[model samples]
Target: MESSMKKPAPDQHDFHFWTDEKFRIADTDLNGHINNNAVGQFYEAGRGEIISSVLGPPAKRSIGAALARVQIDYLAEAHYPGMARIGSRIARLGTSSITIAQAIFVEGRCIGMAESVIVFLDKATRKPTPMPDAVRDGFTLLG
Candidate 1:
């Protein structure tokens, strides 16, 4: 059966983590607009920040999460040599995974948005595992 899943919209109020990153000349394509890969990288950085804040230091945590899927939508072109504001938040939580919603804005205008699924896993086995209560509570507070 076909599933009906809709993309999430950019909502500033939904995000708890925010960061600003400057785009370099290398990030732009021949067209002088930021490349799709660079946009994804920005989102990844935002996710990493959120994970660190919610789950503690990577070196201290025994269990970690892995990126399972990512869906990004490009709405406008972003030029290089400018700063982009990134925002991220927890959109959904499951027994062993969480969905992160993120957006990229250039000069106060949204240029792209993304949703990513990350699965909690055992460090030794690299298999899915239930999220700890503390982690779940942390997500709740951020959400």
Candidate 2:
């Protein structure tokens, strides 16, 4: 089955935050290219950096963030023995959620892109809650 959650691909210039991840030899598959799962992990790493940058460390924040949904589109093949340059930015920010748009590049060429929806949760109740003003303000700068 195909997913209909596609969004526009982002260029490197559109990113507000950048993360470079080394490709592990183990990330390769029988086809000798980085596997689809590795591409998803690249997005995860980018999102982690975004969260850390916008929300600070876990102990410093009143609320926790959780991944609600992610849609990845693979556009090209990436081989091992190189770095994956992942770029991330806030595509949308809501009262309790933020949507991150990201892309992965190898050798300056875009290989994949993803959109991740993250929701803020109350640490005590573990339920979605409104984000604090400070947190919202921080993310706004990345948009």
Candidate 3:
């Protein structure tokens, strides 16, 4: 029997944060396709940009955010020597946590999608801390 799962499609307008990245030769595996780890890095790049835009640069902040969980679905294989557009948006927000939805597209094809949960925490205590009003408001604007 064939699986009933459906693959995700590329929809850039559905996300608020957008960026484009080029795949390097090193990003490919021996099979000449982009490696899963490279795809993960693309997702990380999107998450980092969103977090920085909302919460300020990590170097200047005493508090920091950490990834609580990340789930990625690989929809299609991607080759190197190409560019990809990555989109990220806030899926949910809590007092000290936020869930981000991300998609990677190459030539208008959805190659991967990911959902990540990040928790804001105090650097010193390493425990969850309420997000600042400014940061929360910034995230709200993106949604």
Best by lDDT: 2
Model 2 error, position 45 (Å): 0.6
Put down candidate 2 lDDT per residue, 43-132, tens digits, no spaces.
Answer: 998999889997788789789999999988899998989999999999999999999988998998999888899999999999999989
Any runs in candidate 3 off by more than 4 Å, and if so which? 1-10
Instruction: Return the number of clashes found in candidate 1.
Output: 0
Q: Return the clash pairs for model 1, or none.
A: none
TM-score of each: 0.91, 0.92, 0.92
Q: List the residue pairs that clash in candidate 2.
A: none
Give candidate 1 regions above 4 Å deviation.
1-9
lDDT of 2: 0.91
| Tens-digit lDDT track of model 3 for 10-99 | 587788689788999999999999999999999999999988887778899757899999999998899979998999999898999999
Ranking of all candidate structures by their TM-score, best first: 2, 3, 1
List the global CA lDDT of all models.
0.87, 0.91, 0.89
Residue 45 lDDT (model 1):
90
Per-prediction tally of clashes: 0, 0, 0
Give candidate 2 regions above 4 Å deviation.
1-8
Which residue pairs in candidate 3 have backbone atoms (N, alpha carbon, C) closer than 3 angstroms, thus clashing?
none
